[model samples]
Target: MVRRVGESVEARLDAERERIALWLPVALGAGIAAWFALPTRTHWIGLLLVLGAGALAGLLIGWQRRFGRAVVVGCAVMALGLLLVWGRALWVSAPVLALPVVTEFSASVESVEPLPAKDQVRLIVRPLKRPDLPPRLRITAAGEQGKGIAPGEAIGLRARLMPPPTASLPGGYDFAQRAWFDRIGAVGTVLGDIGRAPGAGDGVQTLRARLSDHIHGQIDGSAGGIAAALVAGDRGAISEADEEAMRRSGLAHLLSISGLHVTAVVTFAMLIAMSLLALSRRLALAGYVLPLAAAVAALAGGGYTLLAGAEVPTLRSFIAALLVLIAFLLGREALTLRLVAAGALIVLIWRPESLAGPSFQLSFAAITAIVALHESRAMQRFMARREEPWVFRLGRGVAGLVITGLAVEVALAPIALFHFHKAGLYGALANVVAIPLTTFVIMPAEALALLFDSVGLGAPFWWVAEQALNGLIWLAHSVAEAPGAVATLPVFPPWGFGLAIFGGIWLLLWRTRWRWAGAVPLVLGMAVLLAQPRPDVLITGDGKHIAAAQPDGSYALLRERAGDYVRDAVAEAAGIDAPLAALTDLDHVACNRDFCRWTQDGRTILAARGRDRIEGADMAAACAAADVVISERWLPRECAGRWLTIDRDTLPQTGGLALYLGERPRAVTALGAGDEHMWRRPPQVSGNDEAVPTTSLAR
Candidate 1:
């Protein structure tokens, strides 16, 4: 009897596999994603040639009816996909400024958006001169200098330009990589007033800016900003406090133009089209209803994507929705894994670098999990029941929301912990109220407002949207304020994230009890996270600030206010849960105006900033007493000795440093020992002296 049951299960699994051909594209996308994640740069042309030759050989073998023809063909396709991704990455690589330089030139403004700060605006400019530079440069202008700049208008200004900052540590966020993909090679601050030249903004950008301004004029405060963000993807107007609240409450996704917004807009259009078709008996009876509704939904999604600036996330979502609509038009089930796989394939082909972004990861992860759940036997059984009463349907809808919220939260938890080292502990509870309110109230109202605004009759709709937005914001704030709402997690290594992703895919893509095997890798990933080591000391990217980890799991800041951003980043990466302000305790640190000293594991460290202080007698005494000295100023002749030291010249190339203290202390920088990326400066030659050389510091 046991053998018969096992045979029955095997037969069921075989049947299930025959029904789904989606895993092919998914595997292909995985190959492409893997290619993009490599730290080492590839010789794109050479690699593609090699891969192409292998694929051709595989295809020829498969054509001859080889023993494993299907496997050979699949492998060939995946290899080709990886080559395609590599080619795309190479095509998008732009030239960045090799060194910091100040230049004055006039350029056409592509867009003007306010920064989170009070008196700063970011200008996306197209440099008229220096054609060798990247097509676009993102410049941060102080005060009201950039406030008057209009899209497409030519403006002249002098600014210091530098390559985007590298990651603070290896495997941390790489702003330079993101900037490279964005076609922004340089970033800097405006040094003087902008002078207007002869030109107008680009037509599309002008329209978007006008629409954003009109929306803001109609609504008020954070509500207007939220409305603008939903309708036009203009998040510049949103208050930082509200943004923080949404993030803390796990409702930040709602504020962005993501899959949820795209789905909502499409559903709204479909319902409207269906209702109108019902009024026309001939159309409803002619069997054109489903196709017509799908067409309308596709149009709505496309329109929304364009309105939202066709960002990567919105574009991906629209592509997925379009695939589903096409399936519906063809009289097939629309919510299949094949639809998502195809969408992912399209996104990877268009912008392979997007695979590195959080939005891409989170959105696709949620969609994949949801589709898998829909295909599960449990959900199938639940949906198979006969039509129920209104109350039962309402209860089911609420339950469905809860289940979805929980599933997405769980699916994305590992990624969140790996990247940000924080999880919204109360995200499920918060979403129970937040998702419904945003989906049914806020988003719909904003859509209506946008529709009305285009026709100059949007006042009432904007007011309604504003009211709903207020409630949503309040809910986010309240939830964020709850006790233990946020959970700080230990840092998870890249391999841990890899294992978790693999386990999730294995469990979701397969049918049958064998899928339970995925639990092994999932548990192993959790173990890796728990076992990861924390850095004992961290230095800022600018080398102006440093922090030491205390025995009690707190950080001692070397400077009070200079490296606030780095302080927070290091604290999060080190799994320090205390508030930033409370991390530095004077009881454990000794400091004077010029220098601060801290000890960890019996090793003394000294940090100094000002030039005058570095030349003072106090600095000499501190350097003599400490085992490691980090000075913002150039290293003086007197301080050369066995004690390790980092000074101005080496800091720029290193970016940031992480120290591990033991019997033999060691150091690692943001640029790894062997990293050879474009943004990294060339290695510096060191002279033989008592001053510890860069290469010797890590030894």
Candidate 2:
């Protein structure tokens, strides 16, 4: 009997494998295309070569009926699809490709409409209108403009008008690549203006502006206005205190209408729609309840949850909602593993870049783990055969919530560390409280406030909602500040990130009794992090003072700046607060003071002319016998020593002379320099230094 049961389980696994194989091509193709389409400087020939090789490999494998032949064919198809998609994106299809090299520009908002979290202000600009340039042109303005600008008003901007860079953080994050899936390629910020903003203030934007004004007018006295903003996604009117409250409470996600908020709205709408349909029982309409509920869910949840914002998590949730709605409309099964996989595939296909984002990984990991736990036979039996009191039932619910938080925290911990460089040690506990409050209390209250507004009794409702959100904020801030709230993680190598991803997928999808197999990546990721190499040169620089520490030894600085922001950054990066003090006493100097110094065995040498600045001299002779020549000024023209400039003005085009002298003239010890020309030439000792016998400076 045990053998038979094992065989049945194996058969189910095979069936799932077969199902995944069938739909694999679409997912693979979309992913490949998106990868190739990313902004890169490589030529098309390389891509074409890859395409040909993949096609040949697929053909050969299929002809031989090799292992994983079906998978190979699917991969080949996906590669081709990606090549086509990205090729089109890089060439003719992209608007950025078609745009002229714009020089002068100006933007004026024709309208500004309020969205859930931000104001969508539309602006039109005359881009490079010179007859010598492209005459007919327009630029749309958007994003991080600081404050909301109104219609009929214009801001002057100067920029090299081109398509926005594809979203991908170089070493951090990418917003443009995600927007590519959403079909937005162009954006701009004001630089300078040729004239005033152009346009007449009128239409729907005006109405939205009026509504925003009216809401603020009504709720300005209390926290109600910001509450309305949170509900409506008009963050422009929110007070600093209210914003702080939500941020502190870890409930900031609520302020922005996201998956949690949408799920609640849809569930509530679904319940209402189902109840109304149930009341009409005798009409043979039992089958229609789900469909009606789904439609209402779409109406209430779709725009706000999905369409209202650019956040990738909302889009993922909306995709799941779509899957659920379609299933209901067809009277099929609900919320299964297959449905989750399907939703994931859809999101990956549409926004391939999102695969690397925290939202996509965290949201889906939490949901999938929760669903798996919820569907376990053990869990079902416990819930069904519970002969316990209400207290026990409540305890079980709390236990379930705790389990959910742990699952999500486990899944997201590596990613959070990888991205933020700091892991939230208490995030799980914070989430346990914050998630329930945001989902159950905050979202519903905000929605109710909207309803109250329609009934002309929103003021009281809005005030109550504000208090709830404020309480949540206070909770997050408190949690954030709790002892050991976050722990710093050593930087991990790139391969570790790949390993972590591999392990996460294994845990989530491996159809094996030995689920512990997924722990492999986790262990490897941690190992890689522990083994990372330190940088050669480290700088803790803000806009003011600059500090540098060599890998071999001590630290050096030009001077202490106005603020500690820079000094603190350096100290943190170097993992030493003690070394920064050596830099604090450095005398205050001019903005461009190119000081260079090195501290060794408690000895210090100033490379530059001490208070007396020199224009031309064999300064190298003075520091020839010293441990190191520290400079706070330019290299004397006649010094003729191997020196590397540490100063900013290294360009020859900017009226400064470029020099190169080195038998390996150590590096021209400037703050910075013009070019490699200075580093390449043999050291030439001119004037008095020519007769002085010199030794090669140690690297």
Candidate 3:
């Protein structure tokens, strides 16, 4: 019986060998993820690459066992990925600013993005006179200060600048890492009058910028902004309210120039190319028009990508589209798992840091799941039926769209929740209308409008495009405003998210019944999320904001006027749906001019919000009396608490903290001890740092 079981297990493993190569990218991504997970930098590229090469050499030197070879090759690929990211990190390293600066400086503009709504233009400038500053800086200029600032122009201006900011909270968006990769060490805001902004932003000088400006000149309101986004990838003109609606309705993807937009542009280019080339009977008879059409489509799509800012998502889509066109020319199958993996590998090799971003995750996961579904036998059979009635074919197409949308949503749930703390409850249904409208109507019309503008016959097309965009905007707002449009749920912990992603990859890649095993981990991940508990108290890096849990199960803010970003972050972490309430409004907490004190479940939390209003000795006595103490200013050395005490001296190392209350209380911090990443600049401590609980801090 044991021999039979071993043979069955071997047979099952052997049957899954066809997809062994597909897991190579998964391994590569894992290696890159491991690099990011480390608290400090690793410079072992040569060692990792050597290990990978040695493994390959071992496989050639009489190591012929199939399972051993598979394991060796997987490890080898992972090592290569780690090596690539390590090298990339070193290549992109730049000095970051340590303090805020307010000085007049001159710089040559490298790029400009006009923002009509805010009456501002963002500039990426190369510093010419400031050797003390980083090589590059990203600054936002007012409409008056940036009246005609364009690329290639040298300009002088006074601005206040600061270093790229770290994450506002644990698992929150970290802009510092992105800035490091982009070589931007400072973010600045121009100092000027808040006068009327340039109307529709007419100062841009590049072709893409000019086109975007002209579109805004032609159309009005949010319609013009939508049109500009489609053509030039400038979203600054879009109103924040409309942008929020798009996000809430899950239609925001349409605003980004990704797969849908690229595919549409390529198809349109191919049709126009074939039509023009087919005018020659010689080309058609020689069977050369299709290949030429593919070439034309690739060129056109590449140009559009450059014009659209070449963001990560657009680049991914462009690379994928270019591959599909090449496959057409070579008479090879398109839309395979290998194709998806190839695109991902190229992206990872180009910018490994993108692996941590939501755009990269969402785009790749959506495409991978869609490709796997299409390649399934059931979907293939459904597509193969050719003798059906027109009605049946139409019905099948609609059903396929709905199914694909739903599948993509399911595949993205963990990632979405992990990042946003909410997912659209009815996004699949919303996309059924929005995708077609954007793809078949708005994009085509916009292209026509641009194509005809040289001959002055484009106004009609522009009008039609505007009307369609208005309808799309209306649909998004309606869906976003409806009841239960979004589901607020607890975001997954890092481990849970990793587990779900692993299971998803397993389910998608393996082409056998045993693939059902993947569902076990998926279920386990969901269970972890459902059982996760909310942190009882929250504090920001600056020690200016705090959130405490009240008896009524609501989160109350220490500051009555907390910004939306802080409030929402606290609310999400607390697993509450409502906005945060003012801590003063809670009856359990007692407040004075100096500090506030609250007692709950046999524990006391004392917070010092006003330093000028209290004496340090008195504050220390108050802290000693409470079980927990939180201070905005530096805590007195003798004021250690019964359970935990945190203040200005430790806030730099902690970055942010989330405290739990109970008999066995714990504290979780955003930044880990001894983290030496370029972005984390926690102050040095000479063995005097407070010792946080290892078990809680590890999480």
Candidate 4:
């Protein structure tokens, strides 16, 4: 009996050994993602320990190869992944201004995009002489000041430049980190920008801008906007209302140029090229027909990538499409997990920071799930069954679409809740109608429009594309208007998301019955979603705006009609569904011209506007009555005792603050909770004389 048990264990271990190579890249990717998700940036000492330990273990395993070779290899690969991500982080961690600076400067516009607002444009600029600064800056211009500015046109302007804003709350979206990877050092508004400078040069951005302009000119209104979005990836032309409707209906992905669009364009190009070649007997009989078709498809995908601005998502899709095309040319199955792994590995090697983004996570998750479903035994058996009647085939197609939509939605639900705190409940129903229209009619027409526009014959194709888009838009609006179409949830904690991702990868990658173990972490992640805590008090990054949680589970703004963005962030963090416009009911708030006061947990909190109003008797009274005093200006020394005081000096380092009121109240700040990395400015060491009396509750 003991010998039989030993034989069974050894057999299971050998079977697992055969699958280790397939799991290596996924494990490596998880390691890289884990590194980026750290609360504080890793130092060289920790990295050295990881690498050295992994190497030592690998060497020992090689010496005793009968037992743990797979484990050793996984450790080595994970360590290597961590090393690569750390190296990428260091490479991209260039510094921006620590404080906001108002300066006059000249830069060449690399690209110009219209904002959602009327008469506003955002210019991506390259600095001419400032090597110390970031490679690019995003500048906002109003009125006609930047109307006709094309890419590669030098413009001189006065602007107030600052580092991209940090996360509004701890573990919230880190715009600063994103800007760092994007090579944008600063973001500013152009005060006055009509002057043309001397130096400018043409680039890919120039070509894309020209193409976008031509597309916009050829089409008009919402139809034109959708056409431009499809052809040039200029989504800014679409109205916010339309965008919102699409999001609510779960059709927003159609607006972005991604895997589906790239696949459609490449497939259409290959089909068209093959058809034309087949028409000519000489070309059809040629030995290189397959290679020629592959090349055409590759070129088509590459051209579309260039038109779409080659952003991270587009680049990833292009790489994946190219890999699939290569596999097809090599007479191998195209949509295998190996191909996806190769594509993912290549993208991570090129830009490890992308692993931290929602687009990268959600896109890859959906793709992996769909591909896994296709390769499942049940799906394969269903596909291999005897031919069915026409009606049965049609029903099967509908069922396939619904299944694909469900798989993708289920795979991406955790990611959506983590990033955006919402999910579209009617996405599958909307996609049932929307995907066919987009894949068959809209995308094909847009491809034809692109081809025709090069020869100044695009009007008819644009019209056809517009008609398809009109149907899609109507469907989106109708679906979004339905009750319970969108479901909002609270943001999941980082660890919960991490666990969910691991479980998802386990389920998708494993090929054995043991894969069901993934359900454990998946369930735990769902529990975490229900267990997440809400903040009692929230403050804006600028320290000028504040919101406090009320007894009824809604947030009340200290000042009305100000800091809508901050209010929204706070509300989302707290899982509150209150509208920004409806947060003006100040019945619970006591306010005068200079100060406003609110109470929570039997503690009075004071928000003062000016230093003059916080002096002498009023100051003493505020300190005596309030548990926390927040002010825009510096406060006096006598007002610091049992209570906490936050003012201008402390606010700069904090960014934003969240206070938890209990028996022993605590607080956390955005900066205090964030990773101390090279991209961020270190917190200042205040002198004793200037130090404020406040306790940091950052964990």
Best by TM-score: 3
| Ranking of models by lDDT | 3, 4, 1, 2
Ranking by TM-score: 3, 4, 1, 2
Task: Please report the TM-score between candidate 2 and the true structure.
Answer: 0.68
Q: Between 3 and 4, whose lDDT is larger?
A: 3
Tell me the lDDT of candidate 3: 0.80
Per-residue lDDT of 100 in model 4: 75
lDDT of 2 by residue, 1-699 (tens): 955874564455455563444245344534453353332324334555565676676566454443235445655656655554455334322222223243443334443444323332334433222222222223433334313555555444544444433211112233334434433334443333323333422322444355555556655522444444444445655555555444433344555655666677778888888788778775325566667767888887766652344356666777788787788677677776678778877776565545556666666666776676666667666656467899988988887777767776666666655654455556667778877776677667766766787878877756666676666656766876677665554334456866775666556654455446768876787667556432222322111234445444344445544255444344433333244534535453222243345442233333342456655544555444344333334455444322333222222222111122223222212112222211111122111213322211100
Name the regions of candidate 3 deviating beyond 4 angstroms. Answer: 1-10, 41-62, 193-204, 551-553, 575-577, 611-613, 681-699
On residues 469-548, what C-alpha lDDT tens digit does candidate 3 reach at each position? 99999998999999888766543468888888888898999999988889989888877866776778888878888888
Winner by TM-score between candidate 4 and candidate 3: 3
How high is the CA lDDT of each candidate model?
0.73, 0.50, 0.80, 0.74
For every model shown, what is its TM-score relative to the native structure? 0.86, 0.68, 0.91, 0.89
The alpha-carbon lDDT assigned to residue 136 of candidate 1 equals: 75
- State which candidate has the highest lDDT: 3
lDDT of 4 by residue, 429-507 (tens): 7899988898898877877888887898877988888888888889989988898877666544678887887888878
Tens-digit lDDT track of model 1 for 1-699: 955874565465456664346556655666666565544555434544565676676565445433224445555666766777667656766667666777666678887786533558898898764454456789999857776577767777778887677777544687887886676778888886777653433223456677787877888778788888887788877787898788878888887898888988899999999989878889988988878888899998999899888889989989988887888778789888778888887887788767778888888888889888878888777756568898998888778777877888889888777777777767877888877787898877777877787788877877788888898889889988898887666445577888888888778877767778888998888778767667787777777667777676766666567554676687676766575443245676776666667777888877774546445443566577788888777877666424578888778767677777878777767665544443443221111123322221111
Supply candidate 4's per-residue lDDT for 261. Answer: 88
